[model samples]
Target chain A: DQQVKQNSPSLSVQEGRISILNCDYTNSMFDYFLWYKKYPAEGPTFLISISSIKDKNEDGRFTVFLNKSAKHLSLHIVPSQPGDSAVYFCAASAQGTGNQFYFGTGTSLTVIP
Target chain B: EPEVTQTPSHQVTQMGQEVILRCVPISNHLYFYWYRQILGQKVEFLVSFYNNEISEKSEIFDDQFSVERPDGSNFTLKIRSTKLEDSAMYFCASSEKGGRYEKLFFGSGTQLSVL
Candidate 1:
């Protein structure tokens, strides 16, 4: 089942600009959402997370906005750098659902210098 | 940084053969999980383990699959009979907490190719 979907296969942005990645979910039961970044041959590294109770969460240059009503979430990175270029994945989980995570196909972000 | 480590970065096996993928989770973590991703697909959850027992498993984790924590640190996933469709990258993850909001630390992954 494709509960989580990242419609964008790839995104390119100029360095020092803003990069926005979007994700949509079909499961309203998912209360927790997270973003992960991964490099070639490496594991996915947690970037940020947001709870359904909150609309926005920011950490350093990364910010995650959640709209529970629309079942959509977006991750924004301000002043994007080349290092930020990687595959971005959005994941969601529901409490008491064995804590299992459902992940989207992923978006490849390329920050051009 | 404390991270999960997996052995045998790549494994090539013949169909119907058995393969065991090993992982070493973070020292202080209490929950362990297995996930696999096909070449062009999203990562799929296989199973979750806690307190030395399986807490949950997905449909992909069938009768032929098993997990074990033989030692205090090592977690292993064994596929009784490999199939060509089983080719994918397997990742092991661990979390400090058991809740859904907890953050999970994942290993680099083991690339399994069933020929």
Candidate 2:
């Protein structure tokens, strides 16, 4: 059983447009969520994270929204640049536990110029 | 700008042989973890360690697998007997604390191939 799930395998968006990626989880115990981006042959780089205490957190052009009531979260990138194209993974973990992160299968994003 | 580092970007070992994948986590981080992804599969957690002992491990981490923090900076994952199914990209990560919300920094990963 996959506790964290990303139903989409890929997504495409035109440059300068808003790109939205969604994720879902079955475990209500998860109190925090994170998004990581990865390119070919490199490790995943931390993008943004949101704690359950707040529904949203923003860092520059990236924003993460969490809906605990729905057991879901989403990452939004505005004015999506070409450099933002990569595999985005959604991860979550139980509250107050060790830093054990459960990652989604990843969604491949393509930014078209 | 601390980052996790792994040795031997790639490794190949014969079946039944013992193989150890090494990692040097961020200089000051205290929590370490090991994860792997088979081609076209989700990244799965193998084990997590803190204070030189394992905090949690998954069902996939069987008796054949073991983790050790041999020194102040080095963390290792050893497969006692290699199997072809073990071929995958192994990533090592570290965090400043064991808090559930802590963001982890990962290494480039070592591609392990057991023939």
Candidate 3:
């Protein structure tokens, strides 16, 4: 099912630059969005999340922006560091869907020092 | 910090054989979930368990699959008859609550290879 899609398979950015990862979802029922970072052989770690009620949520250097009208969400990381290089995935869930999350294929982000 | 733990980092089994993947979720978590990701694919939800019973399951979770909380802390997923397509990284996740807004804490994963 193509419920959630990450069109960019890979991204590269210089250190200290801003990194933006985009995600699109077809199901409008989704009310909660989340971002996850994963290393090569490890499970995805929760990054940040935003609810439908708000358009933006920020934590430290990470910020998540949601555009319900466009059915899109984006994760922005400022002053990117080499340690931030990893695969990022976007997931979403509906209120009555028993918290079943729909995940994207993921985007590999590489930060060049 | 507490983390979810999984056993058998990798397992190779023959098709039609039965396989069980074990996981110990973080202490004090009330929700448990199983998700699998095939090579070069997105993670897919299999099932979610709470209060010792399954609360939700995806279409991918067929009769061949089952989850149980035999004890108080350990949660297990069993594939009665494995298929080649069953080969993937299975992740065990836990959340403080089963609400839509709760974030999940996932284990490193158990890679199951069905030949």
Candidate 4:
């Protein structure tokens, strides 16, 4: 079962534009959400994360917004750069879930120059 | 910055053979985990190791699977009598604490091909 889902399999945007990737989770118990970026032939790297109590978290150009009532979250990359082109995965976990995360099928983002 | 490291970037094994995927987490990290992703599939959690014991495991982690921190720095996952379905990219991750907000550091995955 896919507890977390990223309906958009791929996305493309021009460099210096905004790239938004959406994610939805079926489980309401998930209290923590995160976004990870992965490059070809490499493991995923942590991008940003948000707690259930907060609606948004930002780190440099990357910002993650969580809508608890809607069970959805989106990652926003401002002024997207070519280097940001990669597969992005959204992951979630509950507060007492022992750090076991559920991941969504990633969205491939391509920023064209 | 310290990072998690996995050995043998690629492994080819026959069905029914036992294979071990090794990982060396950051020395200062206390929580470790194993995750795998089949081709075109989402990354799935296998197990979480904390304090040298399994904290949680998904249905994917069956009797044939086991994890151990054989030494202070090494955490390993062993699949006994592997099946062809076991072919996938296995990732090792670690975090300083098991807190909900802590971000995980993932290692370059080990690609296992079951023949």
Candidate 1 per-residue C-alpha lDDT over A27-93 given as tens digits, one digit per residue, 9 for 90 to 100: 9899999999999888999999998989999999999999998999999999899999999999999
- State residue B54's C-alpha deviation in candidate 4, in Å: 1.3
Fraction of native contacts under 8 Å reproduced by each candidate: 0.84, 0.87, 0.82, 0.84
lDDT of 1 by residue, B5-87 (tens): 99899999999999999999999999999999998899999999999999999999999899999999999999999999999
Clashing pairs in 1: none
- Candidate 2 error regions (>4 Å): none
* Candidate 4 per-residue C-alpha lDDT over B1-115 given as tens digits, one digit per residue, 9 for 90 to 100: 7889998799999999999999999999999999999999999999998998899999999999999999899999999999999999999999999876778999999999999
Comparing 1 with 4 on DockQ, the higher-scoring candidate is 1
* lDDT for position B110 in model 1: 100
* Candidate 1 CAPRI level: high
Q: Write the number of the candidate with greater lDDT, choosing between 2 and 4.
A: 4
Q: Residue-wise lDDT of candidate 3 within A14-94, one digit each (tens)? A: 999999999999999999999999998788999999999999999999999999999999999998999999999999998
| Interface residue Cα RMSD of candidate 4 after superposition | 0.9
Writing each residue's lDDT as its tens digit, candidate 3 over B72-112 gives 89999999999999999999999999787788999999999
Candidate 3 true-interface contact recovery: 0.82
Best DockQ goes to which candidate? 1
